[model samples]
Target: MLDKTSPSLPRGMRYENQLAMIEGMSLADIAREYPTPFYCYSQSAIEQKMQACLKAFEPTGAKVHFAVKANSNINLLRLMAKAGLGADIVSGGELTRACTAGIAPADVIFSGVAKTDNELEYAMHKGVGQYNVESIEELHRINTIAQRLGVVIDAVLRVNPEVDAGTHQHITTAKKGSKFGIAYSQLDSALQTAATLSSINVRGLAMHIGSQITSLEPYSQSIQRMLHWLEQLQAKGFAIDRIDLGGGLGVDYGNGEYLEYSDYAELIQASFANYQVDIQLELGRSLIAEAGILVSSVVSTKQSSPNNFVLLDAGMNDLLRPSLYQAHHPLLAASLSTSARPETFDVVGPICESTDCFHKNYPMLRPNTGDLMFFTVVGAYCSVLSSSYNSRTLIPELLVNGENVRVIRKAWTIDEQLKLEE
Candidate 1:
């Protein structure tokens, strides 16, 4: 089952003679020990990516807060916390995870458009750092909850700057028609109303244009917009202390290419050069996406009409980005013959639906039954979005540090999952 280095692999992911190693350990060995249809992450890769991000934003004095929704595994959170990164959470569960992972409550920022009253109450009780208030009603709700708890809650109004982040339409949050943040047109009235809230400390401003953004122009525009509003609010006697530029830096899913953190930091520092405010970044994907891979075993290969199909044991239940967002995650055979020729494959999952397909007419090394296939750049949304669709139990998550591999999240059995309601 050994293979040679093929041109199909990404830069970081390569075949060392006959073994596919991520960081230092053999991916095939990990897959065999943990079984197929599992997610594996590289500790060094995640740390390197995180450090790069922090270094980039150091000039602007921006605090790095890892978005919990991206990869909420407590172990990953613990790693992030140990690296001096905070948490940007959207739910009570995520908030609890952040706390349990040893992240300080003062380092947690609660963010969500439709946060429930219970969630607000819990956030206030936990004394989370900031609430990215999305709507006027939500603002009032947080204020009321904080007042009930007899504590002052710090918050930032998430304004919808209506700028197109030039990303996927579904992920575009700050667009004119998006339901994410408060309308920019009514920001003035919203701020006035917010300032009147007794238990709410309107500390600053926040804006997230969109996700998977490659260019820095949208961010520059969004920052300028927020700064202009900040100046306007300050002129009206409001003291803004922070500006949270929500994180959505995209990764190179197709290839090993991405805007360097240094370059991104330069852009951010240049944009905020004349201003001084506590800058906060909530980066999620860019820091973790490329650090992980999904390894699945090919169940069978069949010749379909006008195409060859390679079916995997891992389906949409394991990784949903392909079906959900038509995302492109690079795929390669874990073992490849030096003389094997490249062939176009319709790589698909075991799901019964047509959307379960991972790639269509994609060219890669030919795969055979029981052969391992490594899906790259899936460290972010893949595992978090997994489910028990078709009653397939959730898979395990392995963390690789040097030559060590630890199962961070154990795979669930169907019976164990059924025990939930029992």
Candidate 2:
């Protein structure tokens, strides 16, 4: 039946009358309204995920912060704000976006390895809730900035537990030499250094192992290590009132199993049952990835020896995950014929580089020129990482709420791109 949903499709998506639909709106219909290579998100899907995450972590009294680095569209941020999620930003611009989207500064947690002075000053002026201090030098810098601003800034020491998250190496942050948090062995020294900083109040600890972590072992190990230190620090007379267990919850991107929110929350509650501190989680891809899809049109088809290439209008400049991290996203045809035979095709983009390919030897229903396609599970790191490479114009983004759709971001035209140049 046309109303039946497919198990292969992500949440908020289904195949209706052989056409892929998002929140009841067909991809083909939306493609006609907006140009191809645009991103479309389901407002309900995101809200539902947020609700599930909140429910899962509610037992631990965890404050969920949406990682601003993932899908930072103002409308999406506003939706996150409306859902009672705080912003975990890595830069000043994201802080501005969060605030502009109606998130209060007091709810923002500023986190990044190399926060510039200007960004720190701006965050301080805006009264960000906390800063995740990465290094002792950064701690001193924050102290100097706080002293200059005549304010005592609340901060958390991000400790590197040296746990392997088993995610992509490029995304892992907590390994021994990963240049993320301070090494676990150096925690005492970092705490000592923080003790000397008159203007910085080290109220808690933080650790972000990596992104897209599916296994529970890594989180278990890391949290155990952090809790051990938390106990030691308290024994040493430090008042740690919070624990920022940075987000690395993974989402299924055509890969196998991912960590369930309930399992994750149960782990957190079990680990911290005896502690009386505020727990914070900064979730990014987990909450948004499944809610979004990138729509593109097949530009042309090429036949080469042992390979059928489906060239698409969407390039790596639009969605870099495949090229950048060899990431895999489910590629589907917007409309498929009932009797269509599956074909193996190397899906590629029109970019000049050879790395512009999306998938190789991917089996899907045969696509023709002008056929609409979708790169599913791209809500998190896709559009935010897009660049105007090869002079390609930036694509637009649309938010779908049932039958209602609105353009959240307008396409960046060549004229607008040229205005920044001399």
Candidate 3:
């Protein structure tokens, strides 16, 4: 049973009978305008989620950086920038996008384990705010680049707290044996090394345990560890003025409950009060995941022995989370009569791979060919991970505000793909 009260359900979204409506516009009407196999994002819903996150972290004066990898749609980036949000980017292209989208360079934090020399040079030239250095080699690279550029580069040493975030193994970052951050045993040496570099300014430290994290325990533990490190660094006469608690806040994905913003804020405020340093949060999925969904139409239906299947035009190439992480997204009919019967279906996509399925034996109002379905909680990683595999045209993305709908990205044509080769 779907819980209507779940925080994962964005504002202005409701069910008029069996038809899903966003801000009073029926999904069928949206499909008629935009066609099937497209992504529709609710502008008001995105704003609501962003406001909730800001409100939760308000007491601490922490700046929230919308993680760019989640969904770096230029339009969405502009919306977030307009809301006074910063950007947490992992690549040079993302940095360009963030700046072009109106996020000031000072508001951008570059994070990733393997930042190349060219990327680091580009970031320094752009006057990027801070570099979350993952390894000693990277630290040296920053120092060398800054020396050549004749400017001091601000940076933070990313530490591995070894806290088991208890989330998906693929997303876990800080646990022992993970190749993400500076090892705890080598932090002192790294700080010593940083102090010796004339072009490097060790502003503070950063850490990201994992993504899709639903519990606050790991976050609290990681924060405590960071604070302890801050104290030690301060005692050692290192002027640490900032602490970036990396983002991994999770949203309910129909698999489990999420830690409410109030509770999460309380936990963060309690641990962060001991220090006077500026705080930064790198939030990705939680702020945007529930704000959008994939709307696809049923191409056909079939039965294989004891199981039934419903095929859609959207495939793993459209949204890779299910094929990559075995993730779950609640499926619902876009429109149905009150007399529609409920049946279990293995909803799948048009991809050729065997892992192209979205839902397996999930009960829903039985849909016929040409009927529409909504894959919930796909705002973050869906379109961002889409591809042109199997020679399929890239899907379009639409933004809805109140009853008005507009296209953010148009469907790429086969000719557009061919033009690249031409």
Who wins the lDDT comparison? Answer: 2
Can you write out model 1's per-residue Cα lDDT over 306-339, one digit (the tens) per residue?
9999999999889999888889988877775777
Residue-wise C-alpha lDDT for candidate 2, range 1-422, written one tens digit per residue = 01124756788888878888899799988988898989999998899999989999998899999999998999999999999999999999999999999999999999999999999999999999999999999999999999999999999999899999999988998888889988878889998999998999999999999999999999999999988999999999999999999998998877656889999999999999999889999999999999989999999999998899999999999999999999998888888776878889999999999999999999887788999989888999999999889888899999999999999999998889999895
Better of 1 and 3 by TM-score: 3
By TM-score, the candidates rank as 2, 3, 1
Candidate 2 residue-wise lDDT at 421: 92
Go through the candidates in order and give each one's C-alpha lDDT: 0.85, 0.92, 0.88
Question: Each candidate: how many clashes?
Answer: 0, 0, 0
Best by TM-score: 2
Model 1 stretches astray by more than 4 angstroms: 1-12
Please, what is the TM-score per model?
A: 0.96, 0.98, 0.97
Tens-digit lDDT track of model 3 for 1-422: 12366333455577777578887688889998787899899898889888888888899788999999999999999999999999999999999999999999999999999998899899989999999999888888899999999989899999999999989888999999799999988898899999999999999999999998888999989888998888998999999998988888888887666767778788878887767899888999988888888999999999897989999989999989998999998777777567867889898999999999998988877678999888888998899999989989899999989889989999988899999998
TM-score comparison, 2 vs 3, better candidate: 2
Of the pair 2 and 3, which is ahead by lDDT? 2
